[model samples]
Target: MHQDTVEKIEHALEGWPLLDSLPRECYGFHYRALCVPIDDRYDIFSYENAVIHKSVTAYYHEETHEYKLRMQVGFVEFCRIEYITNSLEIFGEKLSKELMQLLEDMVTFNPKNISSLVIKKGICDWAFAKELPETLEGYQLFIKPQQPVKINNGSYIIIDYVDFTHASDVTIYYNMYRDEFFGEARIHSIPDVTYDFDSNELVELQEKLEKHLVPRMREARQAADAAAHEGEA
Candidate 1:
């Protein structure tokens, strides 16, 4: 936006509890993120996944291991923070040097959060909950094994959260893995789906679970942040 606005966001991010809000683990990842969804739509299809930051960009992948770094970004961005160890630089920031340096020192600034997991059965997919089929304006309707099955991005299928009336209720998202040092179980982030529920009890349960989910994610994010603190020290 503006230089002053950019500076404010960067400064606030310094104390922004990304992990405290959404904590999950992936690969060798260890951090949580607070971010802006490009759009405000409750269910966005791979919305222009960009973070609000000006930083360096580079290719990052593990050399010896084929482990995939899952960069889940929306409210929070999480992935193996270590993966960016040698993968970034920032010479393009238009902001003055002093302000840019704070962000440069704080984050690696990669907004391309990629994931491979699909929503599983027990957990709630925000996408499925917000799915409004056959009647949604400016969007295509489709049926498939999964909810919100968009084979092609539509005029409405364009998942941009910046323009919507509803923002996703799920925050502080994180993934659970089996081993302490490795990730095995992946929690997927699907856009919210609109559903006409006949069961209030079911909706209540889902809402309860969803409410509880963020804190659990936060725990992991906190752990990740603590570990980061140790390593950085």
Candidate 2:
């Protein structure tokens, strides 16, 4: 949160390719489905929550590219589970470059004390030249694939393990959803976390992406391309 740290982040971001919210050709990407709750006394139509909701729309347009969002928030009993549907669909954004600012903005707009922050789902997409392999070892070769979904087609594969980030307190599920029809490879991460956005956490997430996630994505892409070529022959 220090000015110096903020400045450092800004400088580091200069090298990153700008992420299009809705890229026509989506490569590999990940996004958050945030569950933010208002205080018990707050009404669904309260001015603060309304403004926060509005800001969510405005920020996506002003900061990033224009994309459609699904907004679902309703009045409910205090004891029941509350749903404030706010999710970002990231087409080709690098995690380290975009995620921190997105979280900061979410916290800033909704100034009211948030009761909880749960990552409902995290999605990542990676594209390849040919279809993914039918074998288990081929599935194992994916960058950081998650668990496999039972499906007939080669549209996807899941990473072997769930990546847990203690800093953000989110469990990340990295799955590769292969779209043979579109020739794309996707990594979908569903993280469960307690929402606490701070500068330290931001730095920690960035480090995780740069150190682990990004490299794996690159490697996955390369490996997928090679396998696809081999299949062609």
Candidate 1 per-residue lDDT, tens place, 97-197, comes to: 32223333324422222122323222234443454243232212222112221111110011212211221222211222210110111123223322211
lDDT of each: 0.27, 0.26
Best by TM-score: 1
- lDDT against true structure, model 1: 0.27
Evaluated at residue 156, the lDDT of candidate 1 is 9
TM-score of 2: 0.20
Count of steric clashes across candidates, in order: 30, 18
Return the TM-score for each candidate structure: 0.21, 0.20
Clashes of 1: 30
In angstroms, give how far residue 60 of model 2 lies from its true place: 37
TM-score: model 1 vs. ground truth: 0.21
